[model samples]
Target chain A: MIFTRSTLMVLLLTVTFGVSFALLSPIFTDAQLEQKTFVTHSGRVIETSGEVLDPVYTVSTVDFDPDEFLRNFEYGRISISDNGQTIRDYTIIAEDDKVQEISPGVFFNVWTFNGTVPGPTIRATEGDLVRIHFINNGSKSHTMHFHGIHPAEMDGVFEIVGGNGGQFTYEFEAGPVGVHPYHCHVMPLEEHIVHGLYGVFIVDPKEGRPPADELVMVLNGFDTDFDTENNFYAANTIPFYYQHHPIQINTDQLIRIYVVNMVEFDPINNFHLHGNLYQYYPTGTDLVPSFYTDMITLSQTERGIMEFQYDYPGKYLFHAHKVEFSEKGWVGLFLVKDNSTSEAYYGN
Target chain B: METSEKTSRIKVVTSGIIPFVFVVLMVAYIFGPGADLLDLGVPLPELTIEKIAFEKSEIHVTVRNTGPLPVQVVMADVNDRIHPAAIEPDKFLNRYETALVRIPFEWNEAEPYTIGLTTDDGTRFERNIDAAAPALQMNFEFVVFFAIIGTYVGIIPVMIGLLWLPFIKKISKSKYHFFLALTVGLLLFLGIDSIEEAFDVSLENLGGSFNDVLLIATTVVLSFLGLYYVSEKLTGRADSLRISKPVVIGLMIAIGIGLHNFGEGLAIGAAVGLGSIAFSTFLIVGFALHNTTEGLAIAAPMSRGKLMIGKLITMGIIAGAPAIFGAWVGGFAFSPFSSVVFLSIGAGAIFQVIVIILKWIREEGDKNLSSAAVAAGFATGMFVMYATSILI
Candidate 1:
């Protein structure tokens, strides 16, 4: 009764057209949108593109306070506005510390560098000479084996360890701008890495990529039970740290994330960006990005730089795509907002 | 003149007999020996001998749900005799959902067997199936064929909603509000259900610690506040009490329901892939009913304005296409943790909608507000949803 004569005619035409289209869809359907394609070799493409609708630029202060470890944690682009800087100097001390809890009552005995799980990020421009003074204040011998281009003599190995309070000054050129991770190169590498003697090294591109809000994330895990498997995983040595004190990024600017996976026992780790895809520079080594993807897998010691600008303001989730890791602790949020309205809620 | 009169009389007799025969046939088909043909509001199950292989000692029987309702298949009988080999314990068959029912009956190539399927609904369908009538084969072509079919069935609710839009103008404003209240009531049920499901996951896996509890709590609060901020921004108002724009609220409601349906689709797709065909079938029936009610929620608010047909179709797609997408992925790779996250997000979004609806109701002013009617509508919605859920 609701179908008038013209409406009925239109309905009949639609049905005929709809059936015809369904039958012919395969011939016309593009393999990209109309068909499902899973890339096994390359990373998954969750979302294709992100565009910044409006550009608003203003200086805003965001508090990074959570715990002492998070408060002291350093991120962002190196202040190399003066390219005249020729030398980068850094020092790291290896020590053993007992933690009351890794994830709320889960205790662990950690081997740390510079009194933290992931030592301070050493940022330098390409072709700059990097000098590092390494000291082992712990009872056990420790060495810093960096996953980057350097001389073997500067490599922290057991042979060069002076045991308790021994110091070694190593100098090398930081070339091939990329995110690199440095960890203990002792014999039992898995045990040392799981105990938390790892940190990220960011070597900025020579011309320096356009400055945006930069961040350094080191993926590591803890094996509290002495087993080869990790029970607790964290982005920066603290479980659920980002959930408490989320990283803030003002909208209308590109976000650069340097992610390194150093969990020894786990074979593979991945980072999945929720609601965004980034231009991925694998190990930051290439001038041209290899791909633009929302998720990428990292083997042990693998690192990369991701750049993207959010068009909308929201709590964007950044975490290991591995569900187990995310559920346990390897999850964080990027609270993006406008510069005019957003203020530091968790006052540092 | 005499020849013309005779011919006209013959034509009249011919027409009368044909009409009488057609009426008798339809009545018999609907109510008598041919009842299975119409099926009539009951689930109809059909069985076909799919494939027979030597030395396998089992014959694959394809149990198909051909009716509009899901049926719990209690037993299958061979030649009217109870056979343990023919019945699968705790098996269900969903509407249009098929399963390979294996019976440990040695097949004789020359023999024809009458397979009877008895559903829990007390309806039975019998088929005299030949063991060798072009046996059902599995191949890539068949896989794609079934996938297309599955996808078609998955988006049925969305299609229904789109088709139902033109008549929405006929509904009065008062009726629309009643339906809107009803929609809120159903969403209330859904939001609570989803949250309960998420909390169950947390309790079982997260050990109910402070962080786990806090995670769920914060997700809800953050989702509400985040949407609230967006709404405020859109309306250009700093006041918390300001009513969210109707279109924005409508979209939010649709998005929330879409998320929930996506999760439901994942469950169905995963189940189908895992050979839980009956469970998938039941879910389809359950979710189809739920989605019908959900379509009302999306369309009810827009009754005041003359929306473009294209815009209405887009709204329907946004609200309903997720189920198909979810099913597509879930069929390939099903992850429980991911499902939990989806369900949690859905819960939070729907919770926000519930709050917004309450504010919308309050802003309607005293004269238009009927507390009893709203309450009744809410209870009716809950009842309808609860009733539909029990069928699955």
Candidate 2:
């Protein structure tokens, strides 16, 4: 009896509910979401944090000091008496908490690009030319390089940051689509570049793509004066700073990534994309027609672009190739959802 | 009172003769070099006498998320070729998904021609027309209107087969495992092909989900067999004996039925082809109804007097008739692959049913003759459908 009554009521409700849902659901997002970030305040806050999963890759926190980073980048100077700080201070957390120990004192003093590691991820399409305009307010000279796509003139070989700083533009028609890294190509390659010159770049193919999301990580390491063994950083020296953040994307979208490395001694880096394999190869250099892969590795100045659709939604990781790279400095995580995963039983 | 006896005797005479008439029709349908009794009319030549401009790129396009979540409109275009879109059911089409993606356009002058639209599913909708001229803002919407419809239509045939359960109650209570298994195979293949046809999707697309559909489809077949087997075992022996003359007569009926049903999808194809939009809709509904009752033509006689050969022959006619119809219709319908699906499925199911009947005959030690008859039954069923595919 109860079932019968409920059945009729439920039947009526289903139609009403279905019609309401259709009427309410929007088919497309507004254009404003795609626009670049705008500064609301005069001040800046950088994020700092990191983690370590393997010896080859290390994730440490960037102190996220906007002054040090802002000084090296030429966005704009914030006034002391202005509206407020330009950047917001934030924390970068790791999936596996406390991967590595930082030098000096407390285990945490997380570093972030503007307080976030890998700086705010630089996003661009396959054909779009990307410009990395940077300023070096820090005492040392710095450089930048991208991993996903290759640039003709500026491969980040020279010091990208010194005096008033400089800009590097990355241009290419397209490549195998996937997530890739960018970093300073400067020598001693591990030390200076690793200090904080890394990020990700994504290149999405024009057709038959998949659903994907991105997470960015840039490994940072410093030869602190207190380190007893200069060689110890190689075996297990902790990172001084690091950055981590996520890149949300459209549903059924092919996941594309651009990563860079800034550390010196660690000239080589790898990007492991969890879950779905990267569907496209950047640099127009792929061995197979349907080359599907889980991770992409590159050296300083090299960027690999990855494209893949997320058939299933879930939270996954995108991190450095070198195990030690993640141990102290390089790591990031992203969440992918399309409402289907809203229910519990629908996942692996 | 005298008329009643005569009427009963005449009914007997006619019932006995009906099979003969069926046989003659079958021979004519197959050997008669292409002819259809329901040759209603050449759909295009008869109807659609207006000019409407359809090909102007005034083709305005709008992507509506009539679905729950917003969808990024990928690619939209008008294709010339008419290819049947297959939906791999396992394909993860999200909910409250984007449906009815419209490509709006206006023609400077209206004219008559088949208008077609291609969607993500690969299914195309085509219509024939004679139009006034091209006009401004002519709406040529390429709405993927069938995704939801496909999902729902997927339930119909299964519901029909299920509705038949109470009536098809089995005869004996004794265990008939192999017979049951054979029935399971026949239905399993039939539903798979039907669903496969329905979705325009392939089993191969289910990255990992293929196994799941396989298991479910098998279960449905097995469940039906199990219930029937249990029921038959409890009741009594099924009429599995052969009446030779009747067997031949049943074979004839099988052929005739095959002839008539062959054009089942023709109306839909022709309606769509000639741009009879309203009729095209009517045709799909009408044919779907026509197929549901088709199972009974053979099933009814088999129930009245169970002849293994008769059942096999009936299955052939029931299954093969549609192919011939489909083949004929496919010509004007502009979809050639449609017959392949109908043909393959018709063949698979009939082949399965024949196997079941042959096994029973074999166990009884019926001579090689019965085995030969079973083979003939299977072949005739498949051949009639195969032949019908082109008869159109």
Top candidate by DockQ:
2
Report the C-alpha lDDT of model 1 over B1-392, residue by residue, as the tens digit. 99999999999999989989999898877888866776556333342222222224444445545455555554444554323332222245444334444444445654666665445432445556433222323456644644553444435665575455556667655555676688788888888777776666444322222244565566566556555555545545423544336666677777777777776766666556544567777877777866777777777665555565665566676777777766765565443334556666677778777777767766763544567767777888788888877876
Candidates' interface RMSDs, in order?
25.6, 23.1
lDDT of candidates 1 onward, in order: 0.63, 0.37
Model 2 regions more than 4 Å off: A1-183, A186-348, B1-200, B203-213, B216-220, B223-352, B359-377, B380-384, B387-392
Model 2, residue A299: displacement in angstroms? 23
Provide the lDDT at B85 for model 1: 31
Local error of candidate 1 at residue B201 (angstroms): 29
Best by TM-score: 1
Give the alpha carbon lDDT tens digit for every residue of A1-348 in model 1. 534744664565466446434422222112233322211112322221211000001111122222443324332333232656577667788887545344432345778887767777777777777877789998877888777788878777744575689887767778667888888878677777777788877787778887666677788876654557665577876655775567777777777778888877778999999888999999989879899999999998888988887878889888888877875568777888986676423211
* Model 1 pairs whose backbones collide: none
Error of 1 at A314 (Å): 1.6
